[model samples]
Target: MPKQLFHHFNKYLELTEEHFQEILPFFEIRILKKKEVLMEAGNMCTHNHFVLEGCLHMFFLNDKGTERTVQFAIENWWITDDLAYLNQTTTDFSIQAVENTRLLTITHDKQGQLLKEFPQLEKYFRTIYQISYGAALVKMRYLFGLTKEEIYFHFTEQFPLFAQRVPQYLIASFLGLTPEYVSEIRAKKRS
Candidate 1:
């Protein structure tokens, strides 16, 4: 684990050096190449990945054979199939490295033990999950209430880095639109 990991933990909870030393062993660092699949659909997602560098996308194939992106995680963000990871069930989606990625991961078992051993970590994770939940709610509201163009512009305005880093096709899928529609929106913006 890196000092930055401790720093990230500290943002949500006050932890001492001893706490860092104790929890460090629970997390393992992994590096992934671009296009690498971290977890495939139907397999148990055993760990929650915290991105240290690069990007990852979580997606699933729809009934119509379209790839629908559910989430994207970049540096300092956590990405996982939360339902699968927490419940220890098979995942309904897949996670892939959108670019060369560096991650720190902790297994569910280790996380449970870590919280038992260090109670403060429970608060830390709760805060993180709460934030994630709140964001999910906002995104859901946007998806239901906004038009395709409004959703596109809202996403671009809120996550400019995502627009810059993720492929347009994936972004379009995430926005519930086609690549050609996204291109048209971009052209209209430039004019």
Candidate 2:
């Protein structure tokens, strides 16, 4: 079991090292190259990935065939097409590596089994879901409440790691701005 995972679980619920060991086998470790596709749109979403390092983006192609990033998961964060993964249905979003990444992946069936075998883990998952949902809500608020430049600045302010680590194009996609606009903003910031 990764000490990082153990520490993450402890953030929500206390689990003995022994007990955590028991649940550890339910997950698989995955290493992805930058731009690797983990899940594609129109495929059944079977796995939920937890980031151990690096980053992942959940995005969809727009009507014009431009990629629109909806969410990103960095180290210690979780990424999945939530509804599709839960319902075992096809996903509208595709998940991809933003950089060379390491992740812990659990299939939907294995997750269910893990929960049944370790019911206390339900609290941990539930807490994660709640936090994810709240973050989504906040993202929506930012989308509506902030200007494009403002949104970019606020997001960079809140997550400087993303600004430094993720490509500016992906950041622009996430903020619903054109890459050129993001370049303009960055140029202005320097000047």
Candidate 3:
């Protein structure tokens, strides 16, 4: 678990043994069953979860009572409602386990303590957030200008393993398209 954590941080910044040791105690490992909701709308998000294995989705229910998937985090990714977790407010999104998943969760309070205890580690987290923010912006641009087929192709190219691992319907939701349309696109691609 520490190895996974170490690698995840390394993607952003190098952490020394002392810095890692300071942040290590704040994390707790959690196992989640498929379809389990880790966070719900209207509740404060207490933990930022790092995926060790399997998948999780962050989504919201639309007025039409449909699930609109905002993000999917597979192995080595992180999931959290940033607004709620950082500000201590209720979340508008729900995070659920899409498959049997192992995760490391760090609480908001502990994260603050970590920053104070190991200032160098703060650079790692800042880099992570900057990357996440940039990705979100790219996604928004795609959503605004791209067709469903283009978006699906982009998703496939970006996350080929997830394309195979996740269910088609969930992928459709993530792409903001109907399952039938997504199926048609997939069929066309295969031929």
Candidate 4:
């Protein structure tokens, strides 16, 4: 585990150096290049990845063969097909790196063993999951309540770094807008 992993855990719970060291053995560091697929659709998702650096997005191809990006995980954030990972089943989603990314990944078996051994980690994970769920709810509210342009503005306002670091096309996919519409919105802002 890296120093960043320690800091990420510390944000949720007070983990002593000794406790953190014990937890490190359960995680492995994996690196991916830009556009690399970490996990492809139709496979069983075995690992939950926490981004130590760079960005990753979870997406699926819709009926029309258009990529629909549903989630992104940046530094200190986690990404996985939750239902698939939890049930140890195949998934319809793929996770891809948007940039060169370093991740701390834990296998499902190891995560289970770790949580059993370290009860404190259960609290940490619980907090993380609760916050993640809340964020999903909020994202849904924004997606439904706001107009497409308003959604873009809200997304940019909420995650300014994503607006800058991620390509407009990917952002547009995530926001359910076309790249051309995103361009128009940018031009509107400029004017």
What TM-score against the true fold does each predicted structure earn?
A: 0.97, 0.97, 0.93, 0.97
In model 1, how large is the Cα lDDT of residue 64?
95
Identify the runs in model 4 with alpha carbons over 4 angstroms from their true place: none
Choose 1 or 3, whichever is better by lDDT.
1
What tens-digit string does per-residue lDDT give for candidate 3 at 54-169? 89999999999999998999888889998789998899999999999999999999989988887877888888788899999998898889987999999889889889888888
**lDDT values of the candidates?**
0.92, 0.94, 0.88, 0.94
- Residue 98 of model 1, lDDT score: 96
Candidate 2 residue pairs in backbone clash: none
Q: Which segments of model 1 are wrong by more than 4 Å?
A: none
Write model 1 residue lDDT over 69-136, tens digit each, in one string. Answer: 99999988999999889889999999999999999999999988988999878888888899999999
Worst 10 residues of 2 by lDDT: 1-10
Instruction: Count clashing residue pairs in model 1.
Output: 0
Residue 111 C-alpha lDDT in model 4: 98
lDDT at position 183, candidate 2: 96
Report residue 15 deviation for candidate 4 (angstroms): 1.0
Deviation of model 2 at 37, angstroms = 0.7
Better by lDDT, candidate 4 or 3: 4
